[model samples]
Target: MAKGKVAFVAHCLLNQNAKVAEFARLPGVVSPIIGKLREKDFIIEQLPCPEILAMGLTRWWTTRDIYDNPGYRRHCRNLAKFTADLIEDYYRRGFEIILVGLDGSPSSGVRYTGSSDPIWGGRPQATVDQYKIVPGKGIWIEELEKELQSRGIPFPRATGIPMDSQDFDMDKAVKEFEEFLGESSGVQG
Candidate 1:
């Protein structure tokens, strides 16, 4: 029998190549976090990268406001629906599931997302300095929750690694993730 435990992580968490230029912190997967999940015997499921799906790998660093358009929202909702179907299948099989998002991401942040000045746009020489961390779920996360809720599926608790902050602390993020993972080890829907 399978372990029946899984973690749904943002695509960039598993493949930094999916990130925008100059935004990738690791050469590949975030090994520390992935290692912890493996140590806990949880199967890792990488969620599709919304940004990459909508804009491609050559996309620029952007904020929530930049991506808060109808087309993008529709794209995210479609992806969420597809993902929720798999989640529901897992739930039906009595698998325990959790979500790991990238904090400060426009598409996958759980508790914190990116925002920017009203006049901000992707310029030829644009930098991340215009971006601001705001309190809210990212576009993709919000849509995922909605889709799951619509299907009467119990949404799993989610935690995010602070990848956007200038002062990100890996140890603290990992500790928090561990605590989140350890809580309510019982099987979930």
Candidate 2:
């Protein structure tokens, strides 16, 4: 039997085409994609309801779905919790899952490009590209990877955090992410 359940960590950023496409395919994200992920394809998903006074209550009250706090501090925490919970839920069912989040930055009310959700508990991580854009500091991919490693879950080690400086080609991103996600699905143990 599969060791853990598969839950994708897809972030619906960019155009609908890209977001929906990634959700439909890709690896590391939630499963039940209609067709096969090309391992070289991409696309990215939505949100869920949370029970009050539950896990990370501080996060629940202070997180998203209520206020639009500054810097999206709350949203970040909630996202991390949500993402982690999603994965754990799947694992509980004996299916190894991966959360390949496709994060980006875009104004609110605009297309779902990225979220301000930071990775709580763990220190901030910044990619090379992030430094160039946001400057100062950023969230590193290693933090998440380490957490997953502790649980025997494969974490995403994407070199660059698809910052869109690459020109934001939805088609190319979808293809690459799809293939990457598919490649990992088989080893969900």
Candidate 3:
């Protein structure tokens, strides 16, 4: 029997409706990336939206520092554990899996997670500018990484799909996915 290939994607990547207000870029899934993955015979699994699960859809836009609290961290950890366990099972079954995240997101950014230190650190309200993307994992991604490491499983490097209201670069996302697939194939070969 032929083993299946899978890609675990950020929830909002597959469903823009899951994103917070004013953040969704498309009416539905990120089509280009999804199309490429489908062409490659990848089974797409959309991860749960951590923020939506923890805080309702009406939740305010906050920084990672605010969500770095104990309660929210616990929620993320639990979600991570469940996701990791599922991935581990797939690994054992001879399936290939890749984790895909959203860049600049507070909960799922792979390489450039959003941070609002200056704003949340008691700066004046006027000085509180928009959150900036920095080099780091988001709250949920950090928990997922930790969970994967604890299970003695190699953490799959994440590919970031960037999306904003004004700019939705499907070509960039497709390129990223191609690079990721090439790297994974090279490793297996």
Please list the residue runs of candidate 2 whose C-alpha ends up more than 4 Å from where it truly belongs after superposition: 1-7, 13-75, 103-163, 186-189
Sort by TM-score, best first: 1, 3, 2
Backbone clash count for every predicted candidate, in the order shown: 0, 45, 0
Whole-model Cα lDDT of every candidate shown, in order: 0.86, 0.35, 0.76
Which ten-residue region of model 2 has the weakest summed lDDT?
131-140
How well is each residue in 1-189 modelled by candidate 2, as lDDT tens digits?
A: 665334343333222223321222233332333133223242222322121113322221121222233344344445445555555455556664444433332211111233233422245342323311221111222233434566676553231224333255555655665665546453243
> Which candidate's TM-score is highest?
1
Best by lDDT: 1
Residue-level lDDT tens digits of model 3 in 71-100:
888999999989987888877776777788
Which of candidates 2 and 3 reaches a greater lDDT?
A: 3
What TM-score should be assigned to candidate 1? 0.92
